[model samples]
Target: MSSDRTLLMRPSPAARESLSALTPILHRVVERIGETNDITTLALEPLEPPSMNFRCGQFNMLSALGVGEIAISMSSAPHERMLRHSIRDVGAVSHALCQSSVGDLVGVRGPFGSDWRVESARGDVDQRDTVVVAGGIGLAPLRGAVEELVRDTQRGGGRIFILVGAREPSQIVFRADLESWKARGAKVSLTVDLATSEWDGRVGLVTTLLADAGFDATNSRAMLCGPEVMMRFTARALIDLGMDPEGILVSLERNMQCGVGWCGHCQLGPLLLCRDGPVVPYAGLVSQLLTQRER
Candidate 1:
């Protein structure tokens, strides 16, 4: 095993052209919700509507030119195109994005991506089952789907359960929304990798939380978004609990350039992650793809 540490820095690639429906977003930070460590929620908006729209779970690559571009998921729905990016100040672009003050100008690109199958879940709710597993900012993708499920009645079949795990309680995203969800009777279970005094929540990995949540794996479909390690383990756990492999949706993150898949930047072996899937069935990934890091 390599002992080298992973470095956090901005990618050097030039920014690609933003889609026709997108534009430079000039807005203000109406609110800032800091959780801990440098992860914070920024409620920023554009002075005007984005030329384009995106499905839930799609992401935009935001850039500050020399600062670099980072893919951030849109936490808001289509109607509220006003963008909300939950940023962790980990690298140059991210740090720049987070350091900006109210009313700063930023560039936004296509709601580029292979969107999560939130649409498929529609009208599928009666006696339907749904499960979401997220780690750290992994929760970003799931948040949109959860909101869709909670509000969209066409999907009246399934009961929704969210199992989220973070490094520590402070690293958790959507803290206020979590309480609001609970108050509104949504089922959410949380855990953490490391404990801090501020944490009174469950202590353990997300897999453990999944095991105890008592989901009917046979009928429930699961969406897992997290680091590769967590997503892999979570998929195995779900299968062991009797969920069908085909029923689980996973987002494979790779370096994405042409979000449309032509550039091949986000290819996963034979599959192009940006086009074929950022969301895909676990069964579809080739064994070699699952086992190796991309060259």
Candidate 2:
């Protein structure tokens, strides 16, 4: 679909205004999925009915009253309404999310962007092989994608290889959850740049570890999210490994001030980063990215 036509799918004005209000939801921190290098995972209970539903790989704009707001992906899938966030404590607002008490207040404003193609994968059988590659905080968004394929009762042909990496062993998000998934027979592989005494897993850049993991990619769908550099590199790897540009889906992050596209900070070429996408197919936006900055 064309870019302008794509933005037409965005929510109406009244909905956007309500999102701007930053409705408070008194959700509790039910579980800490993982915490490393100052990033924390929080689980919340909804105080009111959410106006929007989130899918795996979608995100929300969260804020702290006196501090600021940042874009965070929905760690929880639509079926699992339990809101989860993996916040890196690099700034004041993120730090607040880290230090917040179990029964704290959080301003939840989305369920935004395109969701992982779970329902489609559930119905599609043989071509259902999916691979999810993540780096840094990128693992958070794609977690739901993994959950869907692994937990989908109807999807038998679906197989997932979750390859995740971080700066070091201590900074890896969802460590315990990933471990549990692996224990439950989910095909998950983890890596880190800096090895630690406690670490017995692979040690290398995320892309390097891909050398050890192999998959039949003839008709597979691959989803990746993480730092822009990592996503670019991984996209190339998937292409080299036989995945088509159309089959490779990526989540694109830009400086977003408004959930609606009216704010121009998140613009990527003719596309609105806020409305048209946080997710873009390689076939559509590859050339635009190639013409720009290296990082």
Candidate 3:
């Protein structure tokens, strides 16, 4: 394949081993908060937190010793010493990681991939609005960006609009955080794919919520994460609403065996989701890559 087709140049074997990508560092689990039957939020204290600086949408290769390793996104705000991972029990490695108890040591190998551009979203809020759209577990990667925006809003910055959707009300993650943001001046809306009789909230596709999200599309920058199909439609909706394609960002999910570009598992056209991005401008992506299976 053409070198231009890859996100970055592949490092030599020696370089790969010497880099942090292959060297696993031991981190102790400080807490494990369960979100649902299959999802757990884990907080880990690494041996050296400062050395592990990461931005939103980045991932870590977490290894449960004998079980195996998996690529999981960091769910905490930037610069936090206590790194967090919101994981779902979908496979052996994930199940093992979620089952880990407090004080247990797990191998961590990254703070990998590109960022969600929280800083840019915070800049010139008077001229533009930051719109965040997340669905189901997609909220995991978005949690940090939301926190960043919340902090900015608290500092007298502009308001943000967050739209979240889940299969049902029960599947919604970070309910408390969402409410807290809303109370602090963030425009937050919720919807569910299938609503129970008890649910008085909006019930339908997430796109339906856009009709009333009240964001200025021409002056808005959107960050999105969710099921591929959902993101596809969401991007289309955003475009139809007059947002620039370059201003719409999406985080992609892929089979990332290596948290670096060594493995081709996470390649998405001219980019590697591991290195070039898990978060990318919607304008740069091709349809085939975005529709592939989730991580």
Off by over 4 Å in 3: 1-19, 48-51, 121-127, 291-295
Would you estimate the TM-scores of all the predictions? 0.84, 0.84, 0.88
Please provide, for model 1 over 19-40, each residue's C-alpha lDDT reduced to its tens digit, 9 standing for 90 to 100: 2223434345666667567876
For residue 231, what is the lDDT in candidate 3?
90
The local distance difference test score of each candidate is: 0.71, 0.71, 0.83
Listed per candidate, the RMSD to the true structure in angstroms reads 7.8, 7.3, 7.2
Q: Each candidate: how many clashes?
A: 12, 2, 0
Model 1 TM-score is 0.84
Residue 87 displacement (Å), model 3: 0.2
Clashing pairs in 3: none
Q: What does the lDDT read for residue 150 in candidate 1?
A: 66
Q: Please provide, for model 2 over 1-295, each residue's C-alpha lDDT reduced to its tens digit, 9 standing for 90 to 100.
A: 2545334323354555454434433344666644675778888765444434566777788865446777888876667757788788877888877777776656666756766666674455444677788897888888777777677524565667788988887777777779866765567888888998989988888888666676777667788888877878887887888888888888888777776667788777787766767777777566357346522
**Candidate 3's TM-score:** 0.88
The residue-by-residue lDDT of candidate 3 on 11-34, one tens digit each, is 344554356678667778999999
Error of 3 at 191 (Å): 0.6
